[model samples]
Target chain A: GAGVSQTPSNKVTEKGKYVELRCDPISGHTALYWYRQSLGQGPEFLIYFQGTGAADDSGLPNDRFFAVRPEGSVSTLKIQRTERGDSAVYLCASSLQGHNEQFFGPGTRLTVL
Target chain B: AQSVTQPDIHITVSEGASLELRCNYSYGATPYLFWYVQSPGQGLQLLLKYFSGDTLVQGIKGFEAEFKRSQSSFNLRKPSVHWSDAAEYFCAVGVSGLWNKLVFGAGTILRVKS
Candidate 1:
């Protein structure tokens, strides 16, 4: 029905400012993903899409990061100067394009103070 | 350098007993295993996957996994365990066509003693 969805579940910027994290992929899902979880560590990969382009952003770790889904469902993920190490928690996933068994969403906990 | 090795970071078991969680991976060819389960804010929840014939895979709720290619491994099991099943248990390794990254590990909390 409706699964993958991410908004501002939680965010607190301050370091340098500039943040945008959004994702809503599920309906028909053309493949999309973005992961990052610090704290104890686990999720890591950081960019991927299959419909509006961005097949992969090579784990975007530097360059301030950037993401866009154009018209392939919905995706935002954009960070410019924010850094406290960029905080953590920022996941989004979707699948059904071949195999990957993805389907996650309920993240967006960035806090850079 | 694909990798994933969750050699237990925490494990308590005792809500009903019987449970194993260990995974190891080093991709280079056939490998797409998975097993996710987070509950502390919630998000990932796919309990099982093995992308091939029957290497013993059964996900969701009861949970089950066993895809041992010699020694690469793919543990995760469950026989009872119920205190709401504790939480945090991840071990992934997926990378299919197009650039679908997913190499995860460093997880495995599950602590349900009582």
Candidate 2:
């Protein structure tokens, strides 16, 4: 009965550092997604995983961004050499297969200073 | 490339007054539409969605949306506005069922006045 959750409600790091953000999806969910929301802007799609494989990564801004869902229940978003531009609220969501409504988790605010 | 647009950047309405937030989308085919509300420092909450059948859909908190295919729009409306209803509203279009990439509008900020 647990909902999606993300670790590190807030993270502050220097530019060019590497950071990893974790997400625990709801039990039995087969699809996971990551989105980024900048100040005063709507969330932008980052990546999506169907099961353990990333069904779509086109939303990743660049090669520096990567995500993985190894066990099909948890996902980690990786940012390499983070730039100040990467600072934003990272949100995670999960949904049942073939279901349109997605359950979202409280976002992890990442600040690259 | 599917996209969503919310023409109104912000709207303020008196409590108990009728309210409407316009949303327009551009997609190639029959697209899945959604409305979400996000409070400050909170994650998005689904208000309603339109995938088929009915042109009008009902959602939580007395919210409803009408999907007009001919206009490529799905406008959210409520007969009476409440102060708690003030929040950011997003209109999104699901690109496809397989990937389920949602293209969201910039968002419309609603303000309620008593």
Q: Clash number for every model? A: 0, 0
- Model 1: DockQ score: 0.31
What C-alpha lDDT values do all the predictions have? 0.88, 0.91
Top TM-score hit? 2
> Which residue pairs show collisions in model 1?
none
In order, what fnat does every candidate score?
Answer: 0.76, 0.51
Model 2 chain B scores worst on lDDT over the 10 consecutive residues at: B95-104
| Residue B98 lDDT (model 1) | 23
lDDT of 2 by residue, B17-108 (tens): 99999999998788899999999867799999988899999999999999998999999999999999999999988986333688889999
- Show model 2 residue runs off by greater than 4 Å: B97-99
Model 1 segments more than 4 A misplaced? A1-14, A17-35, A39-42, A47-58, A65-80, A89-112, B1-12, B20-31, B35-51, B57-75, B78-88, B97-100, B103-108, B112-114
Best by lDDT: 2
* Tens digits of per-residue lDDT for model 1, A18-106: 99999998898898889999999899998888888887788998888999999989999999989898899999998876244678898
